[model samples]
Target: MSKHPKPNALIWLILSVVVIALDQWSKAWVLRDLPEYTAIPVIEGFWNWYRTYNTGAAFSFLSDAGGWQIWFFTGLAVGISGLLTFWLSRAARGDWRQALPYSLVVGGALGNVIDRLMHGHVIDFIQWHWRDHYWPAFNLADSAIVAGAVGIALFGLFDGKRSKKA
Candidate 1:
């Protein structure tokens, strides 16, 4: 069988860069135009702009660990991003099913790492709520990460089934 052309991982890196740029830009905008802990209603009862900071992992897991969580999370994200980059480089170039999700994950990880370096925390500005209950605030990086994860899961399921049939 003829060999498939090598995947060009650079395209995925470019996508990662775009994600990082958008993530940082949105965070900057929130920082400049919004106040901390204050919620501004964007919808009747579903969404709001609530500027906040997360110094730890999701749901502030280690936020109260006395500042060590900052470096820990930063290091963790950097390490993960590096590994994902390496994985992307080895992935088949024509398989966007693999590249896009990996790139997004790398971008989102790096975006939050930058926040840890620059501000000691991740800036979150988007909130979803109903009545008196509210979800944790999140930012673009978080959104990208979630989207990428979902993509990866969906792709994995479909690809696995396809391979079984082959």
Candidate 2:
């Protein structure tokens, strides 16, 4: 009897490529058009196209640790992306839940990685704020990473509950 091989979610990697493209393109635009350390108002009191740079992990963690944090973060992102790619290979073709989040993480991680390698810092442009408080500046890659992390956490929680009920 002839048997065909089962499909895998590796195809979802296309999303990763798309994410990387968009993230890079946006950063390029910011570099070319946006002024550094200045807020170009987008919502009068809420948002702006504020260009900035980060050399460390989320929320500028370790951003002031001299210079070694750059390579450390780059290696960390690459390692995590590699691990996610491996997981995607093992995921079932129908498992969008697993593939999607993993793909997002890879895309986001690699996108920022490109920045770190080329510019020695990740370029950030989008900014949100109120009258007195402001969220840290971030980029599309950061958004994707946050979304993916949320998906992984939420879906994993649901999965755990499902298995428990079963």
Clash count, candidate 2: 0
- Residues 52-73, candidate 1, lDDT per residue (tens digit)? 9999888878988999999999
Please report, as a residue range, the 10-residue window in candidate 2 with the lowest summed lDDT: 2-11
Clashing pairs in 1: 7-93
Q: Please, what are the lDDT tens digits per residue for candidate 2 over residues 19-112?
A: 9999999998998998899999999999999999999889999999998999999999999999998888888978988999999999999999
Candidate 2, residue 128: the lDDT equals 97
The whole-model C-alpha lDDT of candidate 1 against the native structure comes to 0.89
